[model samples]
Structure formats: C-alpha cells, structure tokens
Target chain A: MKLKKNLALSETGFVFDPSNGNSFATNPIGLSIVKMLKEGKDIELIKKNILNEYLTDANTLEKDIYDFINMLKKLQLNENETSND
Target chain B: MKRKKITVAVTGLNAIDSPGPGVPVIRALKDSTYFDVRIIGLAYESMEPGIYMHDLVSKTYQIPLPSAGKASLLTRLKYIHAQEKIDVIIPNFDAELFNFITLADKLKKEFNIHTFMPSQAQFDERHKANLPEFGKKHGIKIPFSKMVFNVGEIPALKKEFSYPLVVKGKFYDASVAYTPEQAATYFNKIAAKWGLPIIIQEFVIGEELNVTAIGDGMGNTIGAVPMRKQYITDKGKAWSGISIDDEHLMKMTEQLFTSTKWKGGLELEIIKNAKGDYYLIEINPRFPAWVYLAVGCGQNHPEALVKMALGEKVKPYTKYDIGKMFIRYSFDMIVELKEFEKIATMGEL
Candidate 1:
C-alpha cells in the first residue's frame, strides 16, 4: 500500500497530514515503516527489512506489519488500494 | 511605523472551570503590532483571576453586575472611562453583552469610547430560543429543537423527538436524557438555575468542532479559525484543542457573516455528523475562552477587531498555520490577603 503524498514525517516521529491538519505521534518502528511506505516500499520488502534489522520471528513480524498497515488504512494514511500482499 | 497607544477596558476576568474570553482577548490585544494597549480590567467579582494578573492587566476596577440594569452599568463605565481615558471596551460575558450592545452608541457619543459589538437585532435573533428561525433565515442547518416553559411539555416531546435527546438551559447547562423522567429531572435542574424556556434539541451524534471568528460589520470576515477538541473537561470545556484545515467550516463562517453581516467576535458551535452534514449547534456572541488558539494559528482575531474598532481598514486574512494546538492549564498564585481586601473593599486595585 502507498502512503499519501507529502505526509510530513519529522525525525521525532511526528506525523502531520497537511491535507486535513491531523497530527499523530508514532514509535520509532512505525516512523520507519511510514518512511518506507512513503518511498513506495512494498509490504514484503518492509517486513524483510524489519526482520533483518530487528530480532523477531517471521510469523510475529508478519502479523505486526499487517496490523500496522491496517491501522494506516484506518487513519487514511494509505491511498485507496486493496492489495497489502 | 510608530505604534499608537490606546487604553482598552475589558470584562469577564473569571478564568475558572467555564472561562471567560477576557484574558485571552487581552492577550491578543497585547500581541497586536498596530497598537500599544493599556489593559483596564473590569470585573464583577474580586476573585476573578484576570484581576490579579498584574502583568497582563494594568489596573482592575469592580463593575456592577448585569442584573443591576443598563443605567448602573453605563454610570460605572462612565466613571472608569473618565479615569482611564479608555479607547475601547470589550465586554466578554454572555449575560453582560446585551448591556454593552445597548450602551455602545452612548459610550461612543458621551466619552468617545468605542466598542465593536453586534447590533441589538443581530444579538436578539441568535439566542438559543430563536436559533431555528435564524438558521432558516440564513440557510444554515440546525438540529430540530423546541423550547418548553415547564416540565409538563416533557411527556409530549416523545412524539416529536426520540429518547436520548438533549435538554438545555436558556443560557447554560445541558444533559442527555435517556427517558422522559430523566428529561424532567434535568429540566427542573436547569430551569432552577437559568430560568424558564428550556430548549430540547435533537441529539446530533458526531464530532464537535468550533470556529472562532471576527466580522468587520461590513459583511467581511476579518479572520476565521476552526478547531477540534482533543480533550474535554467534565464541565464541557475544551482542555486541549488543535487547529484544523476544514474548508467547509470556513465557508460556513463566511456565509454566516455575509448573510447576517455579523459584527464583532463570535464562536460557532458546530457538529459534523457521520454523514458529513454540519449542524450549527449554537452561536456565542463574543470571543470564546480558546480565542488564543486563533492567535496561535496566525489569524490574531482580537488584534484585527481593535483595528476595526479604531476605524482602520483590516483586510480579510487568507491563511493560517494549521496543526497548532493549545493546552489549557491552571496555575496558583501566592497572593496575600491584602490584595484581595483592596479589590473587595476599595473596588479598585
């Protein structure tokens, strides 16, 4: 899934949606994931990168990434797309 | 350019649970780039926190309450104007606005003291009891509501409205009644406090949003800033809120001013339902307690109001920084009894 264009992600994990002026604060991993999504990174690539950099089982990481992507969709951070595959 | 020095008198110094717009209005005037303001605090109660905010207010004077009638109010204002050479007076309380609006011309003619306020007709038409007709006249959407003078009308309300509706007082207080008995209970409680003609409104379930704005009396909106409450207190006050970029809210504000030519400062209490329809909940006649949020968002409404009061041309502001947030907090000042005694007895501090 692709993140909305021009979502300002500050270094301190502050996410600002300029379109509606909604602001959110996320943890380091969420920030990185948002950054990666903004860069058009696919879900599998994001999952693989997190897996290589962090210590977590493939099953748990996959579940967490899908959960995070679902949350992004709920928050309207992701553009209209059905494929999280 | 040299800044002009002007003395301004303001009321509603109480900054408690339900705050008055006075302190924030003063703060905005202090931040004005065009005028050097000398703040004269007009208060009804000595314990009003703004009276003791020596850094913000130059001096404080006790004024008679609104129930004392316009003659007493005008007489007190005349005395204060003579002593301070007040350039403008901003009355911030809802109960006192009628007196201020009625006295605006006399205050201007007698002492050359200016006040930017809505006209009497404009003020009368926007009251809670008259809101439905106002919305109809302005082509704005308002929830269905009916005013009842007694609890006997509660039983009949079920025919017109469903349970879990809202029972509101004439001036203040509101509660959701899930049953006819509960509606009667709230009806008596609110009526005992604010008096008769209680309003029962259809409960519009949605996010509550507010727009604080200023109109130039000539049908031009000087500034408008919409915000959503992030945290609300039990008293229904916004403890923390953030500015939002909502074009529809802004358009509604402009249309309101363009239609009514509403002068002075006003706060529009709006509810946007899940279906994306906005219902105008209430129209407050003066600046709200969170007016500083508008200033924070770069509109500086009170500053523009002061300029307009002085007959200066103020162009409508086109932009403001979004995502600015305001968190309200309370502070205790260690003041000696002598300070309170001076204001209570001597009537000036």
Candidate 2:
C-alpha cells in the first residue's frame, strides 16, 4: 500500500498529513517503515530491511509491519483514501 | 508606524472549568500589532480570575449581571467609561449579548464607546429555535429539530424523530437521549437552568469540527480557521485542538458571510459524516474560549475584530498555518485576601 503523496515526514518522526491537517508522532521503527513506504518499497522489502537492521524475527516483523500498515489505513493516511476524494 | 493607544472594556472573565472567552480575547488584544490596549475588565462576580490577573487586566470593575436589565447595565457602563475613557467594549458572554447588543448604539452615541456586533435581525434569525429556517433560507445543511415547551410534546416527537436524539437548552447545555424518558429528563433539567422551549434535534453521527471566523459586516470574511478537537475534557470543552486545511469548510464559511453579511466574531459547530456531508450544528455568535488557536494558526481573529471595531479597513486573510495545535492547561494563581476584599467591598480593584 502507498502512503499519501503529500504526507510530510519530519526528521524527528513527526508526521503531518497536509490534505486533512492531521498529525501523528511515531517511534523510530515506525518512522523508518513510513520512510520506506514513502520510497514506494513493497511490504516484503520493508520487512526484509527491518529484519536486517533489528533483532526481531521474520514472523514478528511481518506481523508488526502489517499492523502498522493497517494503522495508516485507519488514520486515512493511505494514498488510496486521499485519491478517492 | 506607531501603534495607537486604546482603552477597551471586556466582560465574561470567568476562566474556570468551563472557561469564558474574555481572558483569551484579552491575550489576543495584548498581542495586537495595530494598537496598544489598556484592558478594563467588566465582571459580574468579584471572584472572576481575570480581575485578579493584574498583568492582563489593568483595572477590574464589578458590573450588574444581564438579568439586571439594560438600563442598570448602561448606567454602570457609563460610570466605568467615565473613569476609563473606554474606546470599545466587547461582551463575551452568550447570556449578556442581548443587553450589550441593545446598548450598542447608545454606548457609541452617548459615551463614544465603539462595539462591533451583529444587528438585532441578524442575531434573531440565528437563534437555536430559528436555525432550521435559517438553514433553508441560506441553503446550509442543518439537522432537523423541533422546539417543545412542555412534557406533553415529548411523546409526539417519536412520530417525527427516532431514538437517540439530542435535547438542548436555548442558550446552553445539551444531552443525547437514547429514549423518550431520557429526553424528558434532560428537557426538564436543562429548562430549569436556561428556561423553556427545549429543542429536540436529530442526532447525526459524525466527526465534529468547528470554525472560528470574523465577518466584516459588509459580506466580507476577514479570516476563518477550522479546527478539530484532539482532546476533550469531561465537560466537553476542547483541551487540545489542531488547525486544519479544509477548503470546503472555508468555502462554506465564506458563503455564509456572503449570504447573511454577518458581522463580528462567530463560531460554527459542524459535523462531517463519513459521506463527507457537513451539517451545521450550532452557531455561537462570539469568539469561543479556544479562539487563541486561530491566533496560533496566524489568522488572529480578535486582532482583526478590534481593527474592524475601530473602523479600520481590513483585508481578508488568505492563508494560515495548518497542523498547528493548541494544548490547553489550567493554572492556579495565589492572591492575597486584601485584593479579594477590595473588589468585594468596593466593586472596583
């Protein structure tokens, strides 16, 4: 799933959605995943990147990534929802 | 350019659990770039916190409440104006607006005290009881509502409305009732405080949004800022909110001014459902307690209102910073007993 094109990700992990002016703060891992999504990386690539950089196992990483993506969808930060308008 | 000095009087200084707009309005005026203001706090109660906040209010004078009639209010204002040489008066209480609006012309003509306010006709049409007709006339979407004066009318409401409707007072207080019994209970409870014609409104589930805007009285919208409550207190007041970039909301606000030529500061309580439809919930005819959020967003509505009250021409603010948030916190100030005694006994401090 793609992130909203206009979502502004700051160096401090502050996420600002310009379309609706909603803001969110994420941890380092969540920030990295968001950055990866912004770069149009697929879910498998994101999962692999996180696994290589951290101590988590493949199964846990995959589940966490999917959960994070679902959160993005729930907050309406996905490109699909923005484009639907 | 040098700023002009002006003496201004403001009321509703009760900054408590459910805070009034006075303190924030004063904060905005103090931040004004156009004028240097000497704030005179007009209060109905001696315990109003703004009276004791010496840094914000230059002098505090106890005034009669709105129930004391306009004549008594005008007489007290005359006395205060005599001492303060007041240039403008801003009444911030919803309950006191009628007395202030009635005295607006007399205040200007007699004491040279300027006030920027909506006309009686404009004010009357936007009341809670008149909102449905107002929506129809202006082509704005509002939830269906009916006014009931007695408990006898509550049973008939089931025919026109469903369960989980809203029961509201004329001026303040609202409750969502899931059954007719709850509706009757809320009606009596609210009516006891605010008095009759309890309004029964259709409950439309949605994400609530609000817009604080200023109109120039000539169909020009000077500034508008839309916000969403990030956190709310138990009393339903916004503890924190963030400014949003909603083009549709801004357009709707501008269209409202264009159609009504509404003067002064107004807040539009709105509900936007999942289908993206906006329903006008209520219209508060003055600056809200959270108006400082608009100032933080770079619109500075109170500053604009002051300029308008002084007859200065103000251009519309075309842009404001979005994603700006305001987190409200309460503070306790320690005051000596002498200061309290002074206001309580002499009515001035």
List, residue by residue over B28-77, the lDDT tens digit for candidate 1: 98998888999999999989999999999999999998889999998888
Worst 10-residue lDDT window for candidate 2 chain B reads B240-249
What's each prediction's clash count?
Answer: 0, 0
| Tens digit of per-residue lDDT, candidate 2, span B97-164 | 99999999998888889999899888888899999999999999999999999988998899999999
For candidate 2, the TM-score is: 0.93
Model 2, position B69, has a per-residue lDDT of 94
lDDT of each: 0.90, 0.90
Choose the strongest candidate by TM-score: 2
Quality of model 1 by C-alpha lDDT: 0.90
